[model samples]
Target: MRQVIPLGTVTMTYPGPVREQPLAIELHNTLYAADGEPLDGLADERGLRAWLGAVRGRLPAQARGADPRRLADVRRLRDAVREVLHAATEQRPPRPSAVRAVNDASRRCPSSPQLGAARGGGMRAAIDHHGADATDIALGAFAVDAIDLVTGARRGALGRCGAPGCVLMFLRDHPRRAWCSPACGNRARQARHYRRTHP
Candidate 1:
């Protein structure tokens, strides 16, 4: 049987001082890619927790305080993100509930880096014109980006871990961040070994 270690301490990364800030589109896609993973039931919820941990690591500034209400928002956004990603992959339109959640989170969580950038003057209009298809996941990304922007790390270091079958999040503090932990890295290596031997 394969071993699955408990996820360990994850390091967060942010960008350095930048002459040009990360573009809104860049932030949107980056966060979406980091948070979206094809998984089993409630994968979205699991992925959302992983994404939030990344946000906590890259926080530009501490939230004024923990608002328990935000936990509810996270749950809401998690569901919306799942619906949106599934719809996009299936080539369907985002449901009204998903759209509303996106809009609400984007508007309410300006602290998120992705949403803050997407809120750039012309961005909302573009989303409106597109009927909110692609922008569904962008809402949660925006909130996370806002948090990233507040942290000094917004400049260059942001990214997702490259580990396969492990939808963990991490900052690019080092050149290599393909896994959230050495354990995941090892698991991936072992899985590759089995594949090579069996196949």
Candidate 2:
């Protein structure tokens, strides 16, 4: 028997666990939407600052000067990541320009490996970055993660939400997982039901 469910109000902002996503993927998803009524999370300096604050220790340091140019750069990187993810989902190579963008950002603020002694006498591999500002470090980290995601085996799990007018992407860990979130799944089902009944 098919269970009937009610559709709740759709919020203007994305409601998902940000921490659960890889930092680069999270950055790519910063823009809450992609269709006609998209929501920009980093629309201004204040928004950028808020996003940086939320990421906190995951990034190198607090951004010193919040400006439009910085926000633009971040948005550019995010777009490049999106491009790469989109290509990966389509099983095709990403654009050379997009690859270059991610590579350039990563090179500008490369992360160094640090060997540290563990509590019981083992060695631990830690990441140490140099000579880059907070924003650059953040971009580099995102680029590195993006490269890993698009190039690694997990790339096969990449999927875009099937819900109508939705442009969200996600890693499909389960065989039956088609939507990016439960809400999107519900919305898709509701749409299917409406079309069936109306037709």
Candidate 3:
């Protein structure tokens, strides 16, 4: 059954537009599902454009899940989540300047208390419990990093997906996550397959 969360009651519901540009223009153009789906519709520049339209309003009046564009938006959000995850997990850690920026971004939130809670534990719980779409995932990663940067959490908890050609962020549960998802993993495998066969 489809669950209906109350307005302003959902976890990790950040304010403002998630993207400033189209998918084609973003540094990470392609996204994959764990099952190796191409995720074609929501990967390129047009995908982001479609997503912005879906999430342009507040909850209660938030984007309609039944809207035809909803699926595309969700897909885009997932990609974004992965990207944010990858960034949050970087090994170098946030520099003081970067930490300052993260703090600035967090402070800009209209709902600071909620943001603070998420930064501490709400986001991680959301990801663990409900799982996350691209948007939610991205927000989760952001929340974690925001806490890390502002509250002085450990720097080593962040990570970048190891998938070649895939650039996204995720928490480092272990030392061996190379790709954002299994699809990227498959892509890597296929590339190897082609190289070995062709050579």
Candidate 4:
């Protein structure tokens, strides 16, 4: 059941951000699909600030207060994290550029980097980051989590939503869980029902 809302000239095609998972997954979900086209939840400064506020508990004070204007850098990190995780899920190598982005952001702080086997079998960075620059520290924190998630035990738990036209990631913490959310589960079921009836 889709409902249209009156929003003058512009309208949203996708559902709002579903952020009940790990920080890295949350970041990857910031860019979701809408009406078959990719949409970015953090497309603007306000969106970035709002997302930062939503995840404040997981971030440092400095990161929480990061200037929203640095969204470009934030998006770069998101892209890197997204690519790295997707590559992990496929058991393939992520591009060198993505690895560099994760590493460069991690180096924003002083830390002892731990080497972990990346999903594709290459050693990658796993950092216990220390705080530094106002906003960069937040980037560091996010990068650190992405590293840990893709290389840590939870790596096996990472999953992409199975619903059609949905581009969200989640941790399949429970054996029975597959969709990103209950709504997506319903969507998948509805599609299945429609296909069975129509065919």
Tens digit of per-residue lDDT, candidate 4, span 75-168: 9999999999999889899999999999999888666667888888788876544556768888888888889988999999999899999999
C-alpha lDDT of residue 44 in model 1: 48
Q: Give the lDDT ranking, best first.
A: 4, 2, 1, 3
Stretch of 10 with least lDDT, candidate 2:
1-10
Highest TM-score against the true fold, candidate: 2
Per-residue lDDT of model 3, residues 74-192, tens digit only = 44434443334344454334444444443443343323122225555665221231323334333333334445432345445444456665444444456676654566678888989
Top candidate when judged by lDDT against the true structure:
4
What is the Cα-based lDDT of residue 108 in candidate 3?
Answer: 34
Candidate 4, clashing residue pairs? none
> How much does candidate 4 score in TM-score?
0.80
> Candidate 3 at residue 45, lDDT?
36
- State the RMSD for candidate 2: 7.6
- lDDT per residue for candidate 1 within 97-160, as digits (tens), equals 8767756766643332232334445443122212232233334345444334323544345444
Cα lDDT of model 2 by residue, 3-91, tens digit = 12222342132232253567776786676654446777677765565565555546654333323358888888988998998898888
List the global CA lDDT of all models.
0.42, 0.72, 0.39, 0.81
Model 2 lDDT, residue 127, Cα: 80
> How many residue pairs clash per model?
19, 0, 19, 0
TM-score of each: 0.37, 0.81, 0.38, 0.80
